[model samples]
Target: MGITIKDIAKAAGVSYSTVSKALNDSPLVKKETKQKILRVADEMGYQPNIAAKKLVSNESRTIGVVWPTVERVALTTLAAKINAALEQQKYHMLLSINPTKTAVDLFNRFQVDGVLVFGEEAHEEIISSSIPLLYYGEPGPATYPTIDVNRRKAIQLGVRHLVQLGHSRIAYIGDLNPQHSNQREKATGYTLGMEEAGYSHLHEAVDSRGLSWQAGYQAVKQLLSKKKPTALISASYDLTVGIIRGIKELHLTIPQDISLVSYDHIPEMEKLDVPVTAVGTPVQTIATEITNHLLQLASGKKVPPAILDVELFQRQSSRSPE
Candidate 1:
């Protein structure tokens, strides 16, 4: 049998109740006593009975992350960051790739402290949930507290920056699918930014269809076929990479030939051949905000839905178009 709290209490010369409070890090236990008990517990190889603790506290101390589109590379990175943040708080993170409804039900049955849903799609179908629910993208019609990055503002920042660099002919490339609200927001921002700059006719310059690297390459190829824009705004990091590859294939140079700006803010963008200027919330910020909000919900605290702001990080890729 494994070493239990009672065994540790005996070894530390404390009551069983005192050992329990110390193990739980309760304030009722003196700091010195708690430290000694923990040390003794470690030396004795004492193991906690999680099942019993859950029964007593009525909490699993676990957060369920319901992400239907696990294949999305950006979401995968965000999830890893969130997992690390939760681990630091002594909370476990459980991931489910199941459909939204199914994942909600599963998490409800498992009685997790809270559920963080990853996308806006199919959120309308989730009419109700027994557990606290926090959404990570567009809130849609759900009543749950939602947290979303300002996708539209991110694109606008890129467009405004390019315009300020004296680039009248600017193009945005990304997935313009109406089904994806996030992409739609970015596309709308591109149009709005152009209109705001008194270049409303340039709204047609939004070349969008897919979110992949090939899509960005093909879109740039097609755009170049007609008339090469002075500057290009890619809707995503992967798309930016593909756009760069396409530019090289056409024997063109960035900034000198065609300035570039990307949508998502990621570390990899800075490490590219030419560090990319990007506009979006940093992954660490997004993860930290989401994790902190989820913890608040788990604690039965009220948290208003949040639309996190994005910022522009200028780097080597952008310059005045010659």
Candidate 2:
């Protein structure tokens, strides 16, 4: 017993075609007539059947976000950023936390205009999907377009910056799993930067094992117990929060005791007890780029893979070793 366009047309004393044009805001319908029709439609409690609408227009005007989990802090922030950008383009963003393959299948069933995948781990196992896809991390299966920050360059530059400040004993703390491509790139950057600076013997990389805040805090505590590094570079914002906690618990102060540099650019870094020096593309910049790529793929356009460079933002957390 749901209200239909015919009912609205009859109630508004107009033909069915005229009612349809007014409801869709077609330019052929006068503004006042459209407004009156809209009012009548609202009063009649008519809800749109999205599936039917999609069948007619061939576009859902929705973008599905396939995120592995909502537990990751950085992922949530980036999702919000992408959502805002999509809204501006009159596209709705929907999120799914299902496994990569499952999420893709679900989005396909829903018939979203496009799918944006966040890379947390290697997705080589994902099967080919017919829908347009744009990845925000490493390129996965199906040869879709991918855009990522240059993680290796970001970490390498962090190490070089610390070395230039006369700190030979700079340690890097992050995930050391070989299967995680992004973290491996960072680990490699730390080693390469050390070798390039002639400080390979003094280089130490602590394994965080996971990306949790607790992992960062415990990694640093164990690292401090065995080695004495004048400077430490923690990878990821969550880990940096834990690193600072571990340092403070030991009655040490940043710069005066141990200088630090983190490997992510976010506003939260500045709000910490000691504002952090960071290296990477700003979150806003990455978000905007990914949004644009997602829209392009949705329109059946191809975008070549992109690797964004990094920049260092010096702050209160790092200084010369005195």
Q: In terms of TM-score, which candidate is strongest?
A: 2
Kindly list the per-residue Cα lDDT of model 2 for residues 170-205, writing each as its tens digit. 999999998888889989999999999999998799
What value does the lDDT take at residue 192 in candidate 1?
90
- Across 1-322, the per-residue lDDT of candidate 1 in tens digits comes to 7888889988999999999899889999999999999999999878776556779898888999988665455677888999999999989999998888898899988889999988746355744787889988857445688899999999899989998999888888888778788888988999999988998886655455766778888888888878878899898887887889889899999979999999878777888789999899999999999999999999999899899999999998999977
Off by over 4 Å in 2: 1-16, 38-48
Residue 71: error of model 2 in Å?
Answer: 2.1
The per-prediction CA RMSD against the true structure, in angstroms, equals: 3.1, 2.3
lDDT of 1 at 217: 87
The C-alpha stretches of model 1 lying farther than 4 A from their native spots are 1-22, 25-50, 120-124, 205-208
Which residue pairs in candidate 2 collide? Answer: none
lDDT of 1: 0.86
Q: 320, model 2: CA deviation in Å?
A: 1.6
